[model samples]
Target: MSLVDFSSDAFIVAFFLYCFGFLFYGVAIIGRKFSNRNPDEHMHKWGRIAFITSVLGFIAHLTFFFTRWAGGGHIPTSNMYEFMTFLAMMVMLAFIVVYAIYRKPMLGFFTLPLTVIIVAFAAVFPQEVQPLIPPLQSIWLKVHVTTAALGEAFFAVGFAAGLMYLLRVVDFNSKEKSMRIQQRWVEFTLYVVVIIIAFIGSVFAFRGMGYEAHFIQETVEISSQGVESTTTDDVKYSMPPIVKPYNSQVQSMDSFLGMKEPLFETPSWMKGVDAARKLNTIVWSIINGTILYGLIRLVLRRRIGAAIHSVMDGVDPEDLDEISYRAIAIGYPIFTLGALIFAMIWAYIAWSRFWGWDPKEVWALITWLYYTAYLHLRLSRGWHGKKSAWIAVIGFVVVMFTLIGVNLVLVGLHSYAGV
Candidate 1:
């Protein structure tokens, strides 16, 4: 087999091991005999074993990385799919380092699923390893992006830590029915995350092997001079859309059960067809996610968080808070130097400008500022408990927007990230 093939196989093996390790870690925290016995007595051993399996998975991930690097003749950090995989691997590595310090098995329960979800999300993008284009074909590209991802991985772990801290300390059991409903919604959001991951994964898994469906789309395009033009073309997509794009001519009688063409035309500058295609695909993914979530709710007959809470009897919110702080403390400076400093260096070489206030650059600054405020409140003002956790959670949301939202919603210098 080719090195790329080997890498793909290794990655698949690693994914299975990570899932198993996730399960094993859950078994560890819940203990052998539950409420009758001491929590995490003999069960801690299982935690160690789970860590071992994850380490084994990480080793395979490493193998995949090196093999793919050797095969591609460049680092596997160019595209979103590759970057996400690399980021997930780094998050696992960071989790391992933190686990060594704190020896917490429950951390794995949160972090592993996240890693799985991220890696699975990576599969949503095209997996083809194309040669690096100009501007992107730079040595500093590797240096700048690599450090940024490593820093972000620790930040991702901080998110997990913060989320766990909130779950444990959150006053969800309120007598007020509205407050209780809000709590259930919060719990429901977690499942939604997983559902989106699964929905995206299923789409890419089946369709990734080069699936395509063509539809004659009646696209309404607005020109720069405020001229409206209606153009029709056969558009191709990898996944089957439940809803067609706005004003699309239907050659094939596919399902348009609840889809409606919008009255407004696409923006003048925007590539209307591509925008429509992405929108349609995303809508279908959400539809699939809702169905999957409904099935999960039907099966469990309770909120996912409540079900997970059954085994969270012995978890420590304080430990979670501390780890979240520490992870951010470690990641911040590294992020500053790489994402900002080295990015400026690379940008100067590429665009002959240090900062142009591009959407990406703006969001990067926003992320930095958000985390900076987080550190300030955490250290100086002594926002150590629930407030800090909320900050950490919000910080990651900004990070996600920087990483994903900017790439998709706002096109700029970092448009390659959309790949």
Candidate 2:
């Protein structure tokens, strides 16, 4: 089998193994709370096992990635498959680092399932081999995608950590805070797992089938004379229009960096549609996925909501609010630099415009403004807790929109992505 196929097999195996390991770790947590066993005993033993398994999975995934890279001689982040793999790798690496620092395995409860879902989606849309498009051939492609994914992973960690903080603080007023805490963990795990499954299932069920174009035969008057009539029937398939290369090679910023023609042909019919659609799909997927998952969890854990409110009765919501800020403080600037400023700089060099307010560009700016407002709310208005967490969460939504929404829905220079 080709290395790509091998990589797919390895990834599937590794993901399943990780899932099993995650299940055990969840049991370990529950075993401590209910079994009257030493929580530390299980925490130390099973946490180590979970860590080791995740590490092994990471190594296997890396091997698959490296093998593909060696065989393909191209960076792996260029397509959906590679992007998901790359994202999982980054989240794993970040989680491991955080685990080492906090010595807390609870983060795994949130992070692992997320990684699994992303990998699962990656598998759903298997990687296909295609030559690198000219725009993706730059060394900056590696730097940009890598840094951006890393930034996103950190933001994800922040989200997980923030949620943990909320869970911990929520039960402060409870008569049995310690007792309820364990149950909270269980509920959180169940909720996350259910949400991921529901999302994947929903996407599978609702994914749009490609369109079918049909032609109908009809008779119409062909002339001013009443007797003259003609019958015509024409059918055309909804094929993307073909766009030929501008030349044998694209103009390069440096003479030493000779121009190379794009590997894939741009569809002429989609002169301005593809990129917008692609960006929109990305944005909508994130928003809809989060909303769907959140609603599902809310429905499943209706009683837990009341329990959570009771727990938070005496806790400082302000601290809960500020935790998200810590995440945003780190994530927002990095996101801006990677997703916007740096991208625009690259665009200027290639397309000769620093900012064109294209759909993607405009959405990015909107995301930037959203975070800017978030910071303003935190600093100027002294917001914290529920309000702040809400803002932080919304900020992520904006980021998602900038990253995926604009690329999919709005037509512009980026229309090449077949959004």
Q: How accurate locally is residue 56 in candidate 2, as Cα lDDT from 0 to 100? A: 84
163-204: candidate 1 lDDT, tens digit per residue: 888777655556688657646655765756866776676576
Clash pairs, model 1 backbone: 218-249
* Model 2 TM-score, 2 decimals: 0.66
**Would you estimate the TM-scores of all the predictions?**
0.89, 0.66
lDDT of each: 0.80, 0.60
Q: Name model 2 segments beyond 4 Å from true.
A: 170-196, 202-328, 372-384, 415-419
Among the numbered candidates, top TM-score falls to: 1
Considering summed lDDT, which 10 consecutive residues are worst modelled in model 2?
239-248
Q: For candidate 2, what is the lDDT?
A: 0.60
